[model samples]
Target chain A: MQVVVPFAAETPKTRLRSVLSAAERSRFARAMLADVLEALARTGHDLTVVATSPLSSDDDLVGVPSTVRVEVDDRPLTDAVDARLPRRGRTGEPVAVVMADLALATPESLEGLFGPDADVVIAPGRGGGTNALVVRHPDFRADYHGASYLDHRAAANGVGASLETIDSFRLGTDIDEPADLVEVLIHGTGRSPECLRALGFELERTDGRVDTERSLDSTSADSRSR
Target chain B: MQVVVPFAAETPKTRLRSVLSAAERSRFARAMLADVLEALARTGHDLTVVATSPLSSDDDLVGVPSTVRVEVDDRPLTDAVDARLPRRGRTGEPVAVVMADLALATPESLEGLFGPDADVVIAPGRGGGTNALVVRHPDFRADYHGASYLDHRAAANGVGASLETIDSFRLGTDIDEPADLVEVLIHGTGRSPECLRALGFELERTDGRVDTERSLDSTSADSRSR
Candidate 1:
């Protein structure tokens, strides 16, 4: 099985710009990618990282213990992933595509997406995106866009492929917004949480929903002591 | 296409005993079944209501306009439903099994399950149950207990069936507990809400989560006026 992780390297985490600076967002995106890579590494499958921009060996892929083959495909998500999808009705091997921003993903959840008996296994994201999927049928292709989970289902139907949808909370939480940072703080077991805390983010409950608030106490503690 | 609705008519909605008496629960169950039958009637599929006990035409099938074939199966859910599943590789027609307590289900949501082009179309419940499913493949069978949605996914894999899971909030909410009554009041457009309202249930919000509270005002207003 070949696993592909599609990353938006050049302009990643644009939704987090309200809370994270340009450099911080870049670093945060890499932290999330590292967490995803760590989980996929435990599965012992061939890993590939498809980045929109070229990644640095000394920076982006640093600290990832697995041997990840990085491919530079600056194209949009749908085209880049579709190009990597084995041409319909040709290959016998199954290919998996996992998003780079699933900060809460674990080996257990990835196993659900990989070990299913169908021709296509889909783990749908909370926001109607296809966070992770394994394509086993040779006729199936990837289509990533608005409500891509539904599109993928229809695509599987189009190719007459057997499909299974895995309902997993961890694989569903993609870190894309300032509010989404709180999930990493609450459920994350990787470098993504440490990276967010270093940037001064903390969990706060507002109107009965868990949200993130930057702690001013970190900077103001010294001034108050004086 | 054959749409089979498995109903527990003999001992139904036992979980809602805290808020409803035995007689009220039976009436409420019948009301929900009527709503579901109405929705299925609009889809133009052959409807079958498989009840654990025989249904009374004067009471259970009273106001439902659709021609529903009723079957009395005293066995458990898995056995009763599996008995109806077509033998593997023997038939090409699809069989749909929908739970009778999906109080929030609509004709539009049912269209999502019926129109999809897959071997199996599953609508999962919030509590890890399979609320509705359309099995297009002959090898597939029903398994409904202890996270039956997951079991169904594995069953599809076991028999090599293609599957799709639809994400619809209306189709997901099965009215089993007192708390689930709120969804019927909030989103139900059928006889279920009218029956609930007649029983004095009203929507209430607490800590930003919607809940249900029986209205004492209707009875107390008459006493207060005197």
Candidate 2:
């Protein structure tokens, strides 16, 4: 089985711009990518990172294992992954596409996406996004758009593919919003959380839910470093 | 400075009957209640457990500290808690009401509910249920019916009480359904997970999500023991 991780290297995670600066967003994106890659690597799967632009430096790929392949695609996510997906009955091999920002993803959580029970396995995010997927049938291609999970289900049905939806909290939780960073602090076990903590992000309870708060002392030092 | 934990001892967790037997549900509910009580006791609050009926035996109170007081109140939840709520300007003491099924509650998570910023602090459950709350105003009382979190907000507004909502995953997560058992196994720190594991519950990936599966060996043995 081969796994492809789609990363937005250029202007990544704009939703988190309110909380993370450009440099911090870049670093955090890479950190989440590293976490995803680590989980995929542990699964002993053939890993390929399809980034929108070239990784800036070795720092951008710090925790990613050397065995994994990194490809600079520059194209949109749907197009990049669609081109790589093998058609059903062509190669008859399973292909998985895992988002780079699944900060809470673990090998155990990723195991569900690799099972051969279905020709298409989709892991839906909290707000109707397709976080991760496995395509066993070559007929099914990627469709990354607004409410992509619904579109993917339609596509799979259109292709007559046997589809299964994974309801995993870890795989479904992508690091996009400032509120999501709290989940990383609570349940994460990788460099993504380390990066957040190093940037002084801490969990605080407010507004009837848990949210992240950066330390004031670290905020000043972080600005100085930047 | 006072905390009330409401419990339904007679027919606890009827929603979980599909997965857990009567005996198992009773044991699991007690385990979750114990977890909540442990977290509350750690906060050093004046703890009162308002049960619908008397506790079966000392076994039902295992893992709960002796400092906590148990009271028998065979009324509906809303009526039971409302009866205990101190009216504004009377005692002028803050009172907290925490659900007995908050298997994920911790001292840290409960801290947010006790903050003095608001006259009423509510921690809404995942599905708009009021999981826990603190009342500093004498006029405000609980209404634990449908969408009680929203109703509590309205009730607080009706009384012109300054309200704050504590956004805590730990406090918000209440163990009710069989599917909720997976969360206890994942992030729980108390005897609830132990109780589940002892019943041979284990996490397994299926249909793209992690779910609990009780072992066949344990199932037969559990039935035999019952």
Candidate 3:
């Protein structure tokens, strides 16, 4: 089975702006790519990272391992992944379409999803969303990660493939905000070794100007309100 | 206030059998020490690491930052920490005595234990044991880290020191057995960065292969049995 991680290298979209800072967005993109590659290596699966950003002279994706191929496109995210799937000879093999942003994806969950006899598998995110999808056949048609669980279910039903859903906390957590980083730090994302290494990625400021205690209390209160 | 952490450079007499495997012992010791230091650093507290082994070596304490002074003693764990406290000039300030084995200790919880007023603070561990102790004065002593939360409370009563117990998951998890490593891997220790990086630190092979699913099932069965 081949793993296909579809990611928008640069999220110029306004919706993402509210969720991620400039540094966080870039780190999120890189971390996702790194995590996908690391997961593949751990699971001993063939993997490809597909991005929708045009290749730049100093692109961060330049020195990735030889086994892991990168495909750059000036198209939408889904289109880029859809185009690359055929070129990689994914017709007969099971292909897992994973989002780069989920920091908590683990090898056990990936292996469970790829188990034999499962024709289609979907991992649902916390907010009734989907973070991962796996299909045994290449012909399965679905817009990746848009109403993902519903779309994939519909696609699986249309194809008459047996569908399975793996509910996992590891697969549910996708880092998108500063608060999300706090959660990741508290409860680790299994694949976030590099992201965790980045210095100054802490909830409390060193100089104590932020009044971190009050800030945390307010954030908790806000979350409860929501 | 100064933070004092007590660690045994050599395994205690009771722990000798468990520490027979040199590699395992090395990894375990390093993990425990590293976690304590990292938690102290994260909490923004000045710390001194006191090793209770008579045969302590510089090699055993390598990679620890220069700011962290190491004190070697032939006495018991509690006494070693007590001896180090006075020399650091923390007589007037409150001092927190932390166990080197509790990887979940966080900065917030540590600081919260001393909020507004200095008191004798106790954090109990999962196995009905104490893992953390904060004292306003060095003279305020209680038998530390035993099956004696109430004993420590009684001792505090004898001294007329204000006693406060801070309940936190981060302060409760102390690595004592093979099963504890699984908790460290899943939930992560506050100081996991260095411990996880040490040589021969394989999460899968630790303690004769930790089957988390089996353990969970057994726990459920035990609960039903109870």
Candidate 4:
């Protein structure tokens, strides 16, 4: 099977601007992408990354030992995925698309995902985005606007393809809101956490919330300690 | 309005056992209840706590300064809610059941929730549980089991009562999982975070996720520092 991981390095993680600077967002986005790559690398699938920009280094970018491909597509996700992914009838092997920020994704979950009997499998996000999906129907095109899972189900039905939705905590979470950082810190099993620590974000209990606490000096001190 | 807040204090927060000891759970539960009480205190509504066990201290449990009442009811959530909530025909004022752990809840959110025109208003949890609800129709009784939001909707339709679902993050979140602590810590403006900190819980970034970190020595140090 072929797997596609998309990265929009151009204007990455705009929602995180409240917590992360532009440079920090880019670095963190890449770190999350690397983690996803590492998990996918263990799955033994033919892997490809559809990128909005070029990668800076292979050191953090884990890939399958012998096979991995990188392609640049600046279009929106739906257009990029539809244009890049192989149609179902063209190949016997299925095509899977995984969101780059799934830091908690594991090989076992991917196994269950790929093992489904349905023609289309959707790993739904908390807010209706399709976090990861395996498309088996040739005519099915991904629609990733608001509540895209429902739209994808309709698209699959248009082709008479059986659809299955996986309710997974790891797959359901995709970092978007400032509040979402807490989930990644607690549930992500990837380099994302390591990057956050490096960025000097520390957890502190405040008046009524568990808050990320950091100072400019703390960032420098943490980096120096590392 | 007669507002009921249910507390299963006898077997409170069983889901939090993985992260907290029994004594710690009780303390945290009381702290959360206090915060909820604090918020509800601002609404100028008649409030009652239907408790599974008698509360030893009502001083810290902020209620309407002059009119908050506590009633002990050992029944399960659905039964206790049905019995305690004011029936529509008996009372001209609307009735609401607010979760005890809504540390992030504010007077404004409650105002918006109570201000809705629906006969039934459901504040849903991350899981299938119902966090808080407002009942305007005499026929509406809260069913808070698995996927209770859907069940409540059906009940509303059965009674021909208009139903609306409130989508506030503060209203939707009820601390249930170890990972859920992050929400309470990041968004909660309650005594729960203070209690958690006193228990030596702190935030730390690790390999793949952000975690609530605690140490035996830190607990001692924190207590001393206080």
Candidate 5:
């Protein structure tokens, strides 16, 4: 299966401002990207990183394998995905879109995603967003906006494409808000959490909410590491 | 308005089994009940704690004032709420069903709730359950089950009860699972979090998810307090 990860590169993870500075948000976004890429790379599929902007010189993709390709597109998510997919490809293979912020996504979920032999296979996010989806039919294109899952289903029905939905908790959880950091730290054990911990961020009870805060003890103890 | 809290006292907070033991679950449930009761009591409305079983003599409702009444009922949640509402009470006054786990619910939210002159007003939980609802029309009743919010809306429509939904984050935060505890710690300053902290519970990032764990440092450092 040909996989494409629609990543917002230049202006990443603005919703995380409550717990992270702009630089920290960028760093955490990259870390999440690295984690998602590593997971996708392990599946041994031909993948592409469709970024919103040109990659910087210092912004290296650490865990991404050489098998993955990179493309830059400045359009919205739906347009970006639509622009990438071919109406008719070599041997008529299927294309799948995986979100880069899905830090908990595993190879097992990806395996299940491709197992369904439908013209269109969708994985919906918890908050009404289309998280990951696979399209085999040429006429089927993604519409990734508010409640895009429904829009995609309509498009599939209009094109007479058989549709299937993949149920995955890990895939369903998308890191979009400050509250979502708790989900990443709890359900993941990868580059993202490691990066946060490295930056002295620890899960602490802030007032009454579970939040990420800089651990003063860690900062002093690991001053030399910085 | 008559406020009826449909509480599952016997099987309280079984969903919290992931992090808390059975005894801890009961204690935490009671603390949440107390918090809800306290919030409701502040509204100066005649309130009743409709219990699934006998509220234990030792179940000292710490913050619950004297105005609240406790009644034992073994029926289902929907039935317990129905049985408690007076047929022809003071000036055909409306009745409300408030879930006891809404620890973050405030007096202001309750004020806004009663202020609305509607046949049926609902405050929906994050996970689709009806957290708190006010039923003015005597013909209207409650259906507290999976996606009860939808059920309530349908019921309201069926009976021609003008439906109103309260949009408050505080009213929506109902503690149901281990992850829900993080919400309690972050959004509320009630007996629930206090009891959890008193029990040595603290927010910790286990693997990658936000989780409640006993503070080992507190156990040693503040041994005398315990």
Candidate 6:
């Protein structure tokens, strides 16, 4: 099975600047890519990252292992996935769509959504959003925008696809605020270019206040969101 | 109050080959120095790192702030602190002896040990050793050698000095073994030259399957002896 992570390289449309600084945004995108790649490597999945913005380049994806394929689609995140589905399906492999902002996503969470029996797998975010979606077949299509969890479920139901919901905090805590940076600094597992960047922000603000208890709180919050 | 961190530039007694590979040891040392300087800056401390080995140069302590003083003692860790205490006491300043090997030691832990009324403050290592010691006056001589915690307490009793002990995991977990590297990676706290040198050992031997929980369990076990 191949995991496809569709990442929008542009800034988010929301007015949540208080939560996500420029450094945080860049870190979030980079961290998601690193985590997904590491997770896929750990789980023996052929990983493909589809960048939805023209700004994302091969150079920007440094530290990513050379084995992973990178594809650029200058269209909306959902449409890019839709266009690539048929080509990926030719290989007869399952596909997974992961967002580029989840700082806490782990391999265990990805593996849970990637079981062979499931036709569709959805990992929901804290704010009723879907951070990860997997389709076992090429015919699967979902409108992955605006309350994407419900949209994914509706799409799965319409196509008569067997749907599975996975609850995972590591796959749910997307960095969108200063507090989110704190959470990541305190409790995140593994390291990435993005996670390191986020850590710089965290250190600048918190000045090393991250303790075992704070780390536990961050991990628990991430797990609860899932 | 000024914080004095005494470091031995040449650790001839410590075996580097067993603990860290050559590449890892150098990297670990550089990273540790960087982190210490950064942490001191963040905490607004009057930081002075006294190098007890004659090999150290003024340029080696770069990145440490101008306000922070750097001195070369060319003596043992204990003897260096004993020699420097009189000059500090002449200025009516209390001196705190912080060992550089405690990877998780932070400025907050330092502040917690600083008590105006206490004549001696000691941070006991998990291995029943002293990682940090603070003395209000230089005249109160105490031998800091093997199993120093008991020796320090006994010396404090002899001098009629008020002794204070602060049990902190951050202060307790010193980097000594390959297993301890996992805890540093998981906790995201504490960095040592020795620990940094062990990073490659962690990367190669563990292949990223570092059992942080197990490492912490070991830490707790070590702490019981203190």
Q: Go through the candidates in order and give each one's DockQ.
A: 0.03, 0.03, 0.02, 0.03, 0.03, 0.01
True contacts kept of each: 0.00, 0.00, 0.00, 0.00, 0.00, 0.00
List model 3 lDDT by residue over A63-181, tens digit each.
34458766666666666656544323544766777777666566775675566467778776533345677776556665644345556678778877788776444565565543345
lDDT of 2 by residue, B1-226 (tens): 9899999987888877777778888888999999999898888899999998998598788988889898999988889998888874567778899999989788877876786579899887654568889988888978876557768999999999998866555676677766667768766878999998998887654433346778877753343211
Q: Cα RMSD to native, each candidate?
A: 14.2, 16.5, 18.9, 17.4, 18.3, 20.8
Which model, 3 or 5, shows the larger TM-score? 5
Cα lDDT tens digits for candidate 1, A1-226: 9999999988888877777667778888999999999999999999999998889756787656649888899887878887777665666678899999999888877887898889999887643567899888877878675557767899999999998876565776677666567668766878999988887777654322245778665432211100
Per model, how many backbone clashes are there? 4, 15, 0, 11, 10, 9
Please provide, for model 3 over B93-167, each residue's C-alpha lDDT reduced to its tens digit, 9 standing for 90 to 100: 777778887765566656655563645788765434567887774456655544445556776788677887664
TM-score of each prediction: 0.52, 0.54, 0.42, 0.52, 0.51, 0.42
Order of all candidates by lDDT, from best down to worst? Answer: 2, 1, 5, 4, 6, 3
The stretch of ten residues in a row with the least summed lDDT in candidate 6 chain B is B217-226
| Model 5 per-residue lDDT at A56 | 58
Best by the lDDT measure: 2
lDDT of 4 by residue, A1-226 (tens): 8899988867788877777777778778888887777788888888888888776466435432345677888888899888755575576567899998877677766776778878899886544467899987778898777557657888889989899866455666677656566555544667888888788765543322334555566443332110
lDDT of candidate 4 at residue B214, scale 0 to 100: 67
Residue A208 alpha-carbon offset, candidate 4, angstroms: 25
Candidate 2 chain B has its poorest 10 consecutive residues by lDDT at: B217-226
Candidate 5 similarity to native, TM-score: 0.51
Scored against the native two-chain complex, candidate 5 gets a DockQ of 0.03
Worst 10 residues of 4 chain B by lDDT: B217-226
Worst 10 residues of 4 chain A by lDDT: A217-226
Candidate 6 Cα deviation (angstroms), residue B75: 1.3
Question: Model 3, stretches more than 4 Å misplaced?
Answer: A12-20, A54-59, A62-64, A84-91, A189-199, A203-226, B1-226
Question: lDDT tens digits, residues B41-91, model 6?
Answer: 566757777876542455455444567677777866678777656443287
Better of 3 and 5 by DockQ: 5
- Give the CAPRI rating of model 3: incorrect
lDDT of 5 by residue, B1-226 (tens): 8898878877787766655666777888899999988888889888888887877566656676777888888898778887755354536778888889988777977787788998889876553557788877877767675557667899889988798876554676678766667656544688988987877776553223344556655433232111
